[model samples]
Target: MITLYGSPLSGNTHKVRMALAFLGLPWDERLTDAAARQSDAFAALTPMRQIPLFVDGGLTLRDSQAILAYLAARYRPGDWDGHTPEERSAIALWLSHAANEIANGPAALRLARRFGLAIPEDHAAAVTARFLPVIEAHLERRDWLAGDRLTIADLAASPYLALMEDAGIDPADWPAIHGWTRRIAALPAFPAIPGWPGEGAN
Candidate 1:
């Protein structure tokens, strides 16, 4: 069985949870204890002490994007991932955007609002102002982020972007993004991300 360690409300953790649910994999969820995360046992797994630590047999993985990629590679194979080199690269590019822009933008805004972090509002807004339109324009022409099918890209990027409203960004301003969230929400086995609920795959 798979074992996932993280907080339920974490967007990073939600990515892993969504991938596992999509693959129909049964896994155990272990809530992280910030204090325990400093222990030697946890340090042995990941020196970063990052949450959303994934354990599958002997494999221990950190980083939400890496965890999602591993799940697709091991379970869905060529199906959930892309088919060609270009397609795979396209997916990877979006995954990078997820780790960078999305994380610094919407996700950071969230940390400031929900968790009382010290993130700068202007910096987060600047990041969102710059990248969100790119996503909006990209989604304006395509249903999915990369290629023509569902890939790790969508799973990696959607969680935080879907929380635009909570991040002080208006969702209605980006109709395409709103529609995209609904489409992803409609994916099979898509799990609700705490405050964000799912309408299930149509």
Candidate 2:
């Protein structure tokens, strides 16, 4: 069995959990607090002290996006794994966007606030202002980021986007984005993280 180390409230960690569920893989979860992550044992497994470390058999992996890709490739045999060249490229593009822009922008601001980190209100506001429009524009007519079907792109982006409420950005404000989120929530085998309530529970 696989062992996942991290807090469920973490977006990065949640993404991995979601992927595992989507792929129908059973794994053990080891919950770790922020302080526990700095311990010698955890640090030995993940030098960077990041959340969502995956240990399966003899292979150990870090980085949530990489874990998601690994799960999809290992468990999903068809298009869901992005078998075609164009599909693979599209998946890479969206994954990069999710990691760089969305994660760094709105997700970072919300996490800073949640963790009681010193974050300027104006800075959070700036992130929200910039992020909403980009997401709104992309979600305008598309059912999913890559195409009509659900893919890792949706899993990679959903957790952080689901927490937009914490940033004081109402899903109601962006109809397309709101609808997209609902669709993601309705996917089969979607796992609910321990700390996070079900969709819209917050």
Candidate 3:
């Protein structure tokens, strides 16, 4: 069985967990606090001291997005994976956007608020204002981000947006994103991650 190291509350960690559940893979979770990530043992797995490290069959992988892609490739294969050249590129694009714009914007603002980090209200408001509309626009027509079918891209992006409540961003304002969340929430075998109540909670 695979072992996942991270706290349940982490959005990045939740992405990997979502992927594992979506693929129907059984994994043992080793919950760790933020300080534990800096320990020597954990440091060896991720030099940057990040959470959501994956230990599987003698291989250790870090970075939540990278781990999700690795698991999808190693386990699901074929169209389930965005393995074709075009599919891979498209998946990569979504993952990059998630990590860069989404993470740095809404996710960061939400984390700052939830954890009582020293982020100015103006900064958080600015991030939420910019990111919410972008997400709303993209989700306007697509059921999923990368391919016609659900892929790692959806799993990668879900947790952060789902936690928008922490940043005081109302999903009610974006019907497209709200509908997309509902679609994702209905996925079979979807596991409930910490910080997000099950479907229809908000």
Candidate 4:
């Protein structure tokens, strides 16, 4: 059995939840906050005290990117990670984008606006402005981010971008992105991100 630790509304946590769904893995979660993370039980699990923490058997992992990569490697193997060096490299690139650009841009925007986290709105907005166009143009001609087929790379990048609304950015501005998220949501067993467009309307 797999165990995940994080908040239900967190985009990062949602990424792992989606992966578990796609992989048909049974998992349970412990919702966390600063209080929960600082507690002895959570500290004994991971000193990092950050989420989404993943525990499978005796193995424990932190950081969503690391967890996503591990899930693909251990469970999906060549299927989700990729088949060739080029494909793997491309997937890695997108994962990095998801962790950095997507996280800093749209995700941070959500943190600031929705949760009032004191993040710099101007900086995040600038990053978001640049990010949306790059992704919009890239996705204009492609269905998936990394390769011709679906992979964890696609999963890695979609959450924050799809949750652009929570960032105060209109999803209608990027039709391709909207369509891409819709495609991802339509996949079998894909879990819903709390505020994604058309969520629960399916």
All-Cα superposition RMSD per candidate: 2.2, 2.4, 2.0, 1.7
Q: What are the lDDT figures for the candidates, one per model?
A: 0.86, 0.78, 0.79, 0.87
Candidate 2 residue-wise lDDT at 140: 94
List the candidates ranked by TM-score, beginning with the highest.
4, 1, 3, 2
Q: Best candidate, lDDT-wise?
A: 4
Between candidates 1 and 4, name the one with more favorable TM-score.
4
Estimate the TM-score for candidate 1: 0.93
Residue 89, model 2: Cα distance from true site in angstroms: 2.0
TM-score of each: 0.93, 0.88, 0.90, 0.94
Error of 1 at 198 (Å): 3.6
Off by over 4 Å in 2: 119-125, 193-202
Q: How close is candidate 4 to the true structure, as a TM-score?
A: 0.94
Sort the candidates on lDDT, descending order: 4, 1, 3, 2
Task: Give candidate 4's whole-model lDDT.
Answer: 0.87
Error of 3 at 133 (Å): 2.0
* Tens digit of per-residue lDDT, candidate 2, span 84-151: 88888888887987877777776777767666666666766676687778878988968887766888
In model 4, which residue pairs have backbone atoms overlapping below 3 Å?
none
lDDT of 3 by residue, 1-202 (tens): 8999988788888888888887788999998887798689878777988888899889999888889778788877755567688988888887887787777777878877888766666765776677678778988978887779888888887788877777667777877877776788788987776555456676
For residues 103-141, what per-residue lDDT tens digits would candidate 1 score against the true structure?
Answer: 999999988887788988799889989998899999999
lDDT of 1 at 100: 95
